[model samples]
Target: MRTAFFVDGYNLFYGLLAGTDYKWLDLPGLLAHVAHVQDPASHLVSVDYFTSGVKPELATRGIQSKEAQDTYVRALKAKGVQVHYGRHQLDPAKAPRFIDKQTRPSRQDKVDIWKLEEKETDVHIAVSMYRLAARQASLAEDGRIDQIVLVSADTDMTPALRAIREDFPAMQVGVILPHRAGIERPPPGSLKDYSHWMRRFITEDELLAHQFPARVPTRKKPAIKPEYW
Candidate 1:
């Protein structure tokens, strides 16, 4: 089976890679392994990673954080992963303050803050997945994508999966939540409802085993692992 993978980079970072030693991930290799595990016949065709560039001013390490992200992106591109960039929108906003874990947020108690959002990522992933499916429908059976795997815990992708399931009955849809094995997070029911199969979590062992080498060669300068990563 020919398979394609769509990754929500932002979701994956926060859900699985944050504070972990697996920052130097080999995206294509990891996804290919997962695909093979799901089906021994699976052949990886393409990997599309959707993410927004890190906002330097908002990042903890400021410029260094941005550089690290850029390096990783370059490395991923070098490894045959197609990266699609979305923009980060930073805006002044007001929202109810978080008082305590047990206390409900009240509109009366609001605070001003900078709201940073990754724009167009979800829409881009959805459109790309649908477009690929549509294109595959027009291609010869051998060239068509047999399965589409979504690597995200975000429920926003549910509609896209549902549409594909409805329109392309022959195309199999799978969801791989980017949750870490030790983390306790409920799987999003909506995503599972639309997908043909769902992988709940990525083990630390898999991540550790699939890391990129200390340096990855690109067309120009090699992409080296960040010192702080």
Candidate 2:
């Protein structure tokens, strides 16, 4: 079974790897482990990772995040993962204006802050999945891309998954929830409804096991894991 993987980088980070020491991940290695366990015969066609650059308006933290992200992206590209970029939009209107009762006294006005929302990543993932599925469907008779795997717990992808399943009934649509092993709940709504199979949750151990080296020596320069990461 030939397979292509679509990963929601933010979703995977916050859902599983955030606050963990596994931030420096090896995308292809993790997917290879997944493929080996799910279908040993599965041949990797491609891996599309969707994420947005950190918002520069965030100042110091943002700059640091961007540097770390850049290193990680380079590492992923070196390992043959296709990186897709989306823009980060700052929404000032959504920023909190009132002091939270839980954190502080209510007398003072809150600071003006920009909420960074990732734009077009979901659309990118959806379009890539659909386009790849369509192209592979044309060669389905030759046994190309037997499965399309989505690595997300976000329900927004449900529509695209449905479209792929409806448009090409022969190809299998699967989901891999990027969460811890014990919290096994699938995403609610159409995603769960459309998924033909749900792969196991990505484990903490797996993330630890499949990490890029601290110093990845690329041709141009060494891509090292950020000290803060």
Where's the lowest-lDDT run of ten residues in candidate 2?
104-113
What lDDT tens digits, residue by residue, belong to model 1 across residues 67-137?
Answer: 99999999999989999999999899999999889999998999999998889999999999999998986
Clash totals for all candidate models? 0, 0
Candidate 2 lDDT over residue span 116-204, tens digit each: 77899999999999988788746636667888899998999989999998898988887888887777674565677898777657877
Error of 1 at 103 (Å): 3.1
Give model 1 RMSD, 1 decimal.
0.9
C-alpha lDDT of all candidate models, in order:
0.94, 0.83
Candidate 1: segments with Cα more than 4 A from true spot: none
- The candidate that wins on TM-score is 1
Q: Any runs in candidate 2 off by more than 4 Å, and if so which?
A: 56-60, 94-113, 140-143, 183-186
- Score every model by TM-score: 0.97, 0.86
What is residue 111's positional error in candidate 1, in angstroms?
1.7
